[model samples]
Target: MSELSLKVLAAGSLRAVWQPLMTSFTLQSGIEVDTRFGPAGLLRESIEQGERPDLFASANIAHPQRLKALGLASRVEVFTRNRLCLTARKELLAAQPSWLALLGNRALKVGTSTPLADPSGDYTWQLFDTLERHHAGLGEYLQQSSLKLVGGPASQSVPNGELAAAWLIRGGQCDLFVGYASYARRLRLCKDLAVIDIPENYNIQADYAFAQCYEAANPLSDFLLSTAAQEILFREGFARNL
Candidate 1:
């Protein structure tokens, strides 16, 4: 029997959830799965640069849509959803401050992924914009003051497989980080981090999408949206499609 293999490029936020699912998939189908995880935009850039992968999964719909427009992939499909959260050291909540008070505190350091290079950062900026409508100049203040800790040109040197947001908070590099709620949930379990909920009005939904780059049928893509896959995603904190 000839060996079957697949190359998959996926977003970093899917790291923890994808492994077990893929392992199950491989065991059942006898297909080898090779995954390269990173920021979705960066992965898209690589695809544009001719890094061909059988599948491309992104944290946002925009990246896959762009690839589809360019004829590099098939139609984009929403696989799962996620939302942003504010993660910080547990000690920061000792005073039990409100989300707004903590975010507006100038003395505390804030961290976010790089806009354009990572969807999480763009969503965070959108949240800032919503804040600006209620409190003038708040958006601009966060854009200027918040540190671009990961998922940008500066993060090129950061090792792969490391969760940038969690790492930054764990290393004392930032007092707070705006990242995926799913990621924050995972980090809170094993680390000294706390997950803070953003107001619903200011929150953004992260719709994860994927498409096959080649013309062949992709079982993995179909499997991702299947009941088994969605169950895992939901358990891992991803929102299910209605």
Candidate 2:
């Protein structure tokens, strides 16, 4: 198989947890692994266009499900899980702010990935939907708040990495970054950032899935589903489907 070079398309949030293992995968297996990381939807679109990726790993389960149902990727495997959280600059955390506090703070700017292009953004919409069900004022709050302090507007590309939501806060551009707590867990480089574990009511479970693409010609696709690969994957923040 021409010495197996696996092209993996995954979420940018995975950079920290996946790099170490991918390095190990390369060294031990002598397989060249090339990765493209970004919002989940964008990556999937790339694969859909016949990008010839060997394996597709995503932060959300829905996209893989869609691909499986559409016959784009075969042998879908549920690999791991994750969830979202709110991140803000440590200086702004005051006596445990609530979602109400998050929406009401006029001085604070809130940013999220684009719902149409990023799953994280979609989760934020779901959170807002929950808020709207009870806090009808929240719908107005979002409209007003979006107009009041956005850096233009919320988008799929949040200036940088998916977790750059912290950057939005640290840079004095925003107050709260709606993002993944586990994804934001390891960015020691971001100073003075504090995280709030999203309440159960606001939480959305993320199940990561991997599928072997039909056009993928790499043997590493099979290897990635192997016990050895899964062990590395487990350490990289994914739980088994079962």
Candidate 3:
């Protein structure tokens, strides 16, 4: 590896966008990046366990903020935003009258990431809370019945290029999966599935944040917030930090 190269730990949801973003950054800045993408919370644990990457990009602000609080990182900033959505088997869609009905069906399975090990899971939990607030007992049922299928330390790894929600739902692992809306477009392409948006009132907004673990990553950090990078993120299913 080049001495000027930087190691970056980023959330798995960024995998699709990060490639193009980094390509542009390297072309302009002449700095190579070695990136590992996974559940943001697990990446944070790796950092806490002495695996030091020059930069950490998280799916949620909380994980990065926790690192900053632990004196392991600097200047947490929200770089992008995402929202939660549901991906369900096409057969399930035909059976249920609505996404809400599909979720409330006691026989159908729901898959979610593991909480505390992945920020996506945390957001899934938050979405459940919103559901409970609006329709008492519904959220609690989801929380109880949902399968923690991915994102935990011991969870099965999602094949590198496959969309987890679609993969799981197609394999009959779950009738429905709750995950980042960033995958909405690609998931929609799958013939076996349907992407359903969580209503704005019930959806949880995911704030993607990043922090520099080493001063050497400062330029990369600055580059991420630039107009070029922001545009790429927006094109790839993320929103500019508002």
RMSD of each: 2.2, 3.9, 1.2
Give the alpha carbon lDDT tens digit for every residue of 58-78 in model 2.
777788777878788776766
lDDT of 1 by residue, 107-149 (tens): 8899998899988888889888888998888778998899988
TM-score of each: 0.92, 0.79, 0.97
| Candidate 1 displacement at residue 140 in angstroms | 1.6
lDDT of each: 0.83, 0.66, 0.91
How far is 107's C-alpha from truth in model 3 (Å)? 1.1
**lDDT: worst 10-residue window of model 1:** 156-165
lDDT score for candidate 2 against the true structure? 0.66
Specify the highest-TM-score model's number: 3
- Which pairs of residues have clashing backbones in candidate 2? 80-238, 80-239, 114-155, 114-156
Which scores greater on lDDT, model 2 or model 3? 3
Task: Give candidate 2 misplaced runs (Cα > 4 Å).
Answer: 1-3, 143-163, 187-191, 214-242
Against the true structure, whose lDDT is highest? 3
**What are the runs in model 3 whose C-alpha is more than 4 Å off?**
1-3
Winner on lDDT (1 vs 3): 3
Give the TM-score (vs. native) of candidate 2: 0.79
Model 1: residue 240 alpha-carbon error in angstroms: 1.5
